[model samples]
Target: MAGEITETGELYSPYVGLVYMFNLIVGTGALTMPKAFATAGWLVSLFLLVFLGFMSFVTTTFVVEAMAAANAQLRWKGMESRQEEDDDNSSTASDSDSLLQDNYERAEKRPILSVQRRGSPNLFEITNRVEMGQMASMFFNKVGVNLFYFCIIVYLYGDLAIYAAAVPFSLMQVSCATGNDSCGVEADTKYNDTDLCWGPLRRVDAYRIYLAVFTLLLGPFTFFDVQKTKYLQILTSLMRWIAFAIMIVLALVRIGRGHGEGHPPLASLSGVRNLFGVCVYSFMCQHSLPSLITPVSSKRHLTRLVFLDYVLILAFYGLLSFTAIFSFRGDSLLDMYTLNFASCDIVGVAAVRFFLGLFPVFTISTNFPIIAVTLRNNWKTLFHREGGTYPWVVDRVVFPTITLLPPVLVAFCTHDLESLVGITGAYAGTGIQYVIPAFLVYHCRKDSQLAFGPGAVNKHRSPFHHTFWVGFVLLWAFSCFFFVTANIVLSETRL
Candidate 1:
């Protein structure tokens, strides 16, 4: 059964919807792209990034189509319930039996509404809000629904781990005294975690301390509801734009001054595996579409809006990655691109340097709590039983504790942002982005065919509606899993 629509907030225009989607898709993932591009070479990264962008867009449409189908199913069931109620009322009223019979005959002749034919499709109406979880329950068999939730849970865990590591790593970079103190130093210099921080603590020890501090501050918020206020979103978005623009402009200036030192290869087959994962991670938005799309007042041009957004995003990624690979040597490029500008010489002004240094710290800090709460809720939903209630301890303490601990522990073990992003995106991210949407759209199409017969058509059907597209997505997903698995196995053996 579809759950009750819980998001009853103010509706927004399509323009706002576009911005929301842009912000959601272009988050922490983009910070790690420049490094991946550097490792994989510019030509190969460019081709793979573009191809992945197209594939992600195709699946996004699949998700929107599934949402419309879920809404139609809910509307059909409600209509059936009302029809049954009318029949019962008509039978019970003995005093007006003749009148009821005449009205019933008229109804039979005209059929309450022509569109309400017993098996006709209700494709045009978009009234209900069916979440991804609800849509899974509606269309997926028992095993499919369970797997969907499992995939989502794993994806969210990765998201939290990335966030957990990012915030502390950024803090360490800014607060510690390190080599390459000036941006004009050798482009290939390396910094190790064993280097000293402030007084006695090594950089790695400081990182652990910061992680503990981060967990203490943000962990409690998971137990409570997190309402991301409008003003806070705007502020963070403003900071994000400023940070990105500064990175691009700084890279352009450095490259223009004949300081360009990168010599990336034409293609590096070894790096392609990790690059694919990073690109896939960057284009993720399917899981959050229900919450994002429901509040938009105008959806007639949603497809067009999504197309424009993707085009803009692709161009932005190309610009950012191209400049970074040219301006800095491949080995020197930081996992988080903003740190490349943290040095005083590259960004002369101390204020600008500070802003760029702390950019991720500011923006991702806000998102950490929100994601933690979402993960907690998904845990509850996964184990929840109908007409059953959890004990106070499990509801308040156990769920929150489990939700907060795993990712924190993962962050403590290592701060390798590239590997973290690569693994998460390649595995759980693939299931959430490619496999699930393909199956949801395929099943939704089949269910509609059975319910409304051959003549029925979904008004919101994906442009890539052929069954071959679904197979292609699944095939791509399988191939990715195989390649990543093989790479891991070979690397382990070599070690």
Candidate 2:
């Protein structure tokens, strides 16, 4: 908790918190989902999506409970520290009464309406933001904490790689013409990197040029702090909603006209690996739960709010993917689904095509710097020592360079957004979403029971509070890693 920045702004109602959670979970992942759905087949995708969403919700509750436990621990320690100070000072009776009144007033400010009588269950309320990293430090051993940082670092790298590739890929699709006559590329024509963009420029060459421009433009912010402005968030969210609405509407209209070209198989194991990864990524809000959940003015029905949000997200995903798979042939689907509409033959409107293509460019460019700075800070934290300072060059230059270089190099190697996303979601996302939550809840519960009496109850405990659920989550995580690794091996062998 010491290293993390807690949310200090005004708290909102739970409904507003619900909307924030929804916005957080449904970003880049949703755009790539339609292709995964088509590849894995509609029926399988639907079932898997529903099941994974449920699993994610269960883990989210686990995280919320851990937060409450963390807050309780901090509160209990503060009280103990005050009591120790009072004892050392040998305070008079009046002073003791005054201190007691002060503590009660502070407790009253929180949801708990009672005084902190030593071992009281009511004193443990989630009135503060305890981030996942802080929780890891509290509960995990030294090695476990290091592993947590490593997993997060890997996930952020994958995130940067995706953002790096997406902007230029979108730009290439929008600017390139098949024959240099200003006619847009056809939807069905399979263009490889070797295909001409301009007369002498290959599509890959054009993408690299844009990649360099993108890096030069946005990469410098890694060295400086870049926070998302309130207006920037509003603008990006507005564009996101408009673009998604357009795509869904267009797909429905196309399908209604009986021009639907997708006839997906009932099931396909070959696509299961990526679909698993994609669903995990899509349902991911566990890592940032503290930031999103702590600002809720009331959390009495927090679990129900989370369930409702998941239901809506699942419905939205179904609508988007089903409509998309039906609107376009499976073979013609693009890795970035928006580019599928950038083709003039599919969209028929130049402005709409360009807007759809440029949407990620606008949103991701804003996000890349924030994420890079965060990764750099995390690097700083990992190597940080007590009562010591980093040198200017290492603190300012070294960490940022290491953070930016790997992802850019990955982008330079290949613009395979699907593979990058799949690997990221499957491995690092698994650790963050599933394994970490399970262990956090497990250890936090034990710590809570020990700190408070055995009879103390955590009001925010998950519905799946039994130890069975925690074991089940860990088992599931291991199985997922195994399955994904095997699939990757088989695919490579065939290749």
Candidate 3:
């Protein structure tokens, strides 16, 4: 009974949904967070992480409410279609009388604003999937929908770029550790691109080689339908948990044995810009909420489940980041946290080092194709027209080529994962995590009230239903843009 299949998708218990949300929110961004935290200073990072987590939670609730509203809109439209069908069908006088009597009885049983149940879920029950793009179309005007697509497209591009860079970066770091060559290197020594990887081959060149290999191997999937199999999902999730657990335990042991090397400052403004962005990126799941929320069998405690999930994610991120900062110096930290354990001096076992070094390669390699295909599909959707079909080349080649090239080029140009993450999260992430939800909830509220009237209630209405909260979210998004841009300007000026 707990697991039911609908036309849209299979349903799971709310607890499973909670786990999915947690997994979605704590991906690559969490790994990049400790360095940002260390650079920004513990005190500042702590305050910002907590505040961003709360803000993310609020926006998540907004998205949930918007989901309910989207469902209601779909249901309302379905009713209208059915009504038209009924009106078209001729009936005998007695049948017409029976229909009128039934309508009157239902009206007497419910309020004027209430919709008649036709053996379907309640109007506001989220039993169907409403993709963010669909919701945007329902709630926003043309300009707004275009802006929504642009923001999300940019975010996905950044995601692909990050994945493209990270896999190669991890491979380079691991491949560089051969025989006895890098064993003598100090733990705090930051290798430059010019550094030797194998004999005369430069690290940067090695990175490019791996990048080419990664592209050649996984790039073709963008042109075709590829999905993460259940087994693959399970494998990646297991690796993720094992990798994080190993890092945390090693950090704790390092601190316990009196070999701790980190001493972060109380506060620092220089790192705040990146930290803010990283925090925002780490907490991002709003864009994918529909896919996650619609499958839940019971949404009675959905908000509560979401709140609990956020709390767990926050605590896990804190544990990972805090342990990392105290266990390693800020300068010694790698953009990929797992790479920090790629040395024998840290993990002491060659196999463990190799596993930690290549973990991102394994996990990210699987995800890159999925994201690329998604981006390609989005491009197709963006330009798609009513009653029009694309040419074979445009359908098959053009979209995939455009989707796969830019991010790969970006990855080719630079592999500065920190800057990639910072800029991506600060701008595109803000639009997704903050701006989109605020507007969606606000617009959806207005539309729902207009369609269903004031007395109609949305069972999944956000706790922060006041107009002030919506305004606050939009104001905060704008403030983030201003803050990040100013910081970039100041940093450039100083340089």
Return the TM-score for each candidate structure.
0.94, 0.93, 0.95
TM-score, model 1 to reference: 0.94
Residue pairs in candidate 3 whose N, alpha carbon or C atoms collide under 3 angstroms:
none
Judge candidate 3 at residue 177 and give its lDDT.
59
Query: Tens digits of per-residue lDDT for model 2 on 392-487?
Result: 999889999999999999999898887788889999999999999999999999998777767677888899999999999999999999999999
- TM-score: the better of candidates 1 and 3: 3
Please report, as a residue range, the 10-residue window in candidate 2 with the lowest summed lDDT.
1-10
lDDT of each: 0.86, 0.87, 0.89
In lDDT terms, which candidate is top?
A: 3
How do the candidates rank by TM-score, highest first? 3, 1, 2
**Candidate 1 on 405-446: residue-level lDDT in tens?**
999999999999998999999999999999999999999988
Name the candidate, 2 or 3, with the larger TM-score value: 3
- CA error at residue 347 for candidate 1, angstroms: 0.8
Better of 1 and 2 by TM-score: 1
lDDT for model 1, on a 0 to 1 scale? 0.86
| Candidate 2 Cα outliers beyond 4 Å, as residue runs | 1-7, 91-121, 178-181
lDDT of 3 by residue, 144-234 (tens): 9989999989999999999999999988887775622555334586898988888889999999999999999999999999987879988
Candidate 3, run of 10 with poorest lDDT = 112-121
